[model samples]
Target: MQLQVLNSPFSQEQAELLNRILPTLTDQQKLWLSGYLAASQFSGAQAAAPAASQNAGQAVSKDVTIIYGSQSGNSKGLANKAAKTLEGNGYLVTLSSMSDYKPNNLKKVQNLLIVVSTHGEGDPPDNAMTFHEFLHSKRAPKLEGLQFSVLALGDSSYEFFCQTGKQFDDRLEELGGTRLYPRFDCDVDFDEPAAEWLEGVLSSLKDAQGAGAAEAAAAASTLQTIESEYSRTNPFKAEVLDNINLNGRGSNKETHHLELSLEGSGLTFEPGDSLGVYPENDPALVEQLLNELKWSKEDQVTVKQGDVRTLQEALQSYYEITTLTKPLLEKIAPLSTNEGLKELVAQGNGEKLKEYINGRDILDLVRDFGPWGDSAQEFVSILRKIPVRLYSIASSLAANPDEVHLTIGAVRYEANGRERKGVASTYVAERLEPGDHVSVFVQQNENFKLPKNPETPIIMVGPGTGVAPFRSFIQEREETGAEGKSWLFFGDQHFVTDFLYQTEMQKWLKNGALTKLDVAFSRDTEEKVYVQHRMLEQSKELYKWLEEGAVVYICGDEKHMAHDVHNTFIKIIAKEGGLSREKAEEYLAEMQQQKRYQRDVY
Candidate 1:
């Protein structure tokens, strides 16, 4: 229905503006607008009431503190967005990273909003470790008058999804703080849920402050039109310039060196940033799923409220089929009549459920639990959207303007009596070619960054694909002619077949952009040596470099390589500096707090 000036409170111009925007908005957008308008009306009504009718005890402070603990910058971005929204609504805002915030100041905060993402196996991100520990410690202060909320981001595929956020939310309430808004635990596709959480928080704040709080509806509407055209929500299609296999023939590993054109996209990135690629599922897997379901390829299904596509097209391009989550199994249980499937998802069967979910896909679920009663649309509704894959950029924007480079390792393995392939990795390695376009966006990482001072020496330890970002670092230093001395320790399986970017590292060392190069080829030696072994071998000089104010950067696998390398650093510090293990640990922690020790491990 069109907005008519005679029947509405809006002026002619306002009615025309509303008419233009209403038809273009999605269902979710319309619902949000309705809620916002209702909140505004309610606030206005409360303000018009007599001052004597107001409850003095319910009055709240206008000051707000937003703290974010981010690994790949998502939480930081959301925290900044929340701060802006609060500021637009006439609230005083103080925004900070969890690592930078002073713990003693917690008792002074009147309102607190935390945005944090859970890392591997439910651990807090590296930057959040200190604060997370402090808040849960015995010396933590009781926050009697504090009002707070939390926004937690995580992958549902993980067993302990959003664990860190949940911990903070419970801890705050235990310390006598009241919840201003309920905590939101978001899955991988968090954009919509996060928006809903922010809107709810704004409504609660407005209700507490009444109409005296400035209205942000007009400002938000204006800001939307000026947002960046390219983002996670709307990625730019970058044309591939080059695609080459970096590994020599006969190597066990396959790594692709890709160069993409960002000439007209206006996307800029630094050395430590990552590139997010949205990849399509394997057509073979999609066909197997279709055949098992006995569903027509041309059946129409709605991906979202307003977006519809063919079943085959949607399965191939939009939905995630490779991984299964506990929540997904629970959602699917009622749709099937299979007793075994239902029993496995029942309470007290968590171990069995976890075992079933590991290394299994949607195809396995359908085959195991036959005769699903739901329609194609209903089945698709329960599945999550395909998550983007992030790779460390391998080239500097300063050295190669309007071009971005990535080093992707193809992932293939045998599991459950069949071969499985990584969606994004294999897509780029086997299918992508020069002149093809891929949807991509740059992911800014504040937690991992090069030092602002060019004269400070840097020590880098990157094995396998972890060497990607260090390549960018060296290229950037070369382009800017920085005087800092840099050292690199890189490792792989075999020197002849698996040594990646060997010639490039040699070139940088020759030009003084890189001062030192150490390589460990595990398979080349009888006993198998890695980068950590090399660090231990050069313990004295490594400790000396640390004493010389050199920054250390590590990038690569988190579970094993990063963990082993971290312990190796402590051993080197203790043995060379003649300190105890405890003191060495403290020294490393201090380095982390000082931003001298940075990691981009996954």
Candidate 2:
């Protein structure tokens, strides 16, 4: 407020009166006033213009709206950053989550920017569903005067790369909205592309709407900018403090509980944020690939920045050889003459190509497709860098200052008669010892968070390692001594060997930190009973809690457990509330809009 008053060319009486009036305006009214100030200020800089701001109290400014559809919060962060940038440029900005936005009011928007992420397959993120549907519906208003752009964040490994983003861009254009900038699609490494896209948006908007740099900068600079010295691209190297297997011996699974020291690094994390770990590939796997290709281990190779390293070093620290994507296949196809490989990539067999890419490794691709190949350098050039893996943090900073913890399930399986290991999971499980350094950075997920109302009840459903964030949540709640009632439903294969954090959880339950607890050990029973079944058995009380306004959180496998649990909730609502399936679904959606239902499924 002080900056707004000081920056404007106003007399003492005028500024004093303005200050009293500004604080009472609603978000929409504030936006209208912001536009007015921007236009009035720019008009003052024009030599031919009179003292318009003095004559007319409110003039129009450049208008922009940033709406985000986020599942894990990457889109939301990017949206915030873009909003800050645009505001710095003197635009009247209104930022909102898609779930909270009013679709009917979109027609009033002059400059629209969407930063969204795709969830599973081709589906929109949970918060984006209704907004996505409304835009495609027959009732959507024509957007002839609107100028828009979209930034899509998605994983390239997925078949439907940026499906939600693509849909929004196409729909807006179909409604007669002019393209402010071309729709920008980004893969896992999105920082660079997103920055470039924001620049393009600002350039286009300023040119079309007449916002000068001087005035734009003054306005946008007033907004707070989020900054961190260490980030995804520039991670902090922290030493490991402890690494222990959570499961007992003879268990079929290997789950590691890792504790890392953040003593000297100023990194911090909240309960729901994720930790991104940059891991090196298994040396054994790299050696096997080198042996299979008959390439020289000592051969010099270059990575991204023309930085030179041995072929062995490059494979270990940089290139991804464990998994293969369709893009990699496309690059390798022309180099091979094998009819079988060629047929998979032939003009019309896209599905067959997808079938081949699934569950196949880079070693398998190289072995089956070639005889006479290029140098090691040529092969390495086509591969992509190994991206960092995100793990739900398991410790709260308030509970254990200067320390961060993670619960990782090491993945090991037999594929094509060879043992394959998960990169970061196994690296921490088998390789890292106490005092060893590991590169990591925190990725904040604002979408999945504890309710601000401490007295509000929360129900957590997490099976396997999905229970990670809940551990942090419990710790945070206990640290604050919050009055909220908390319930946890946990499951694994066996009760004896696989009940992770059992002692601590039991202690919490005894101390009244936990209101209720339920467990499911699938292998112990003759017939399988999962978490969803356990939830169904207690339908009456669950519905009672729902009626009492308790929030429900689900985390685990997206393909099965998440879906099954979701359907189970719909059934419970239908039976317990005596409503039809359709009404139950609608009820669930309404709860979602109210933020009573949230999930962190992978």
Top-lDDT structure, candidate number:
1
**Leading candidate by TM-score:** 1
lDDT string, candidate 1, 143-213, tens digits: 99889999999999999999999999999999999999999999988878887787777767766666422
**Candidate 2: stretches off by over 4 Å:** 1-61, 209-226, 335-340, 371-375
lDDT at residue 583 of model 1 (Cα atoms): 99
The worst-scoring run of ten residues by lDDT in candidate 2 lies at: 47-56
**Candidate 2 local lDDT, 1-602, one digit each (tens):** 45255678897788888788877889999898788787658744751232243335433336899999998878988898888777555566899999999998889997899999999998899889989999999999999988899999888788888999999999999999989899999987787788778877776665454455554444444333445777776799989999999999899999999999988778988988899999999988887778887678999888867699999999999887788777667777787777888788888999988887777788788678763357878878888888789889999999999999999999999877788899889899889999899999988887678999989999999999999999998999999999899999999999999999999999999988888999999999999989998999999999999999999988889999999999999999999999999999999999988999988889
> What would the TM-score be for candidate 1 when compared with the true structure?
0.90
**Every model's TM-score:** 0.90, 0.88
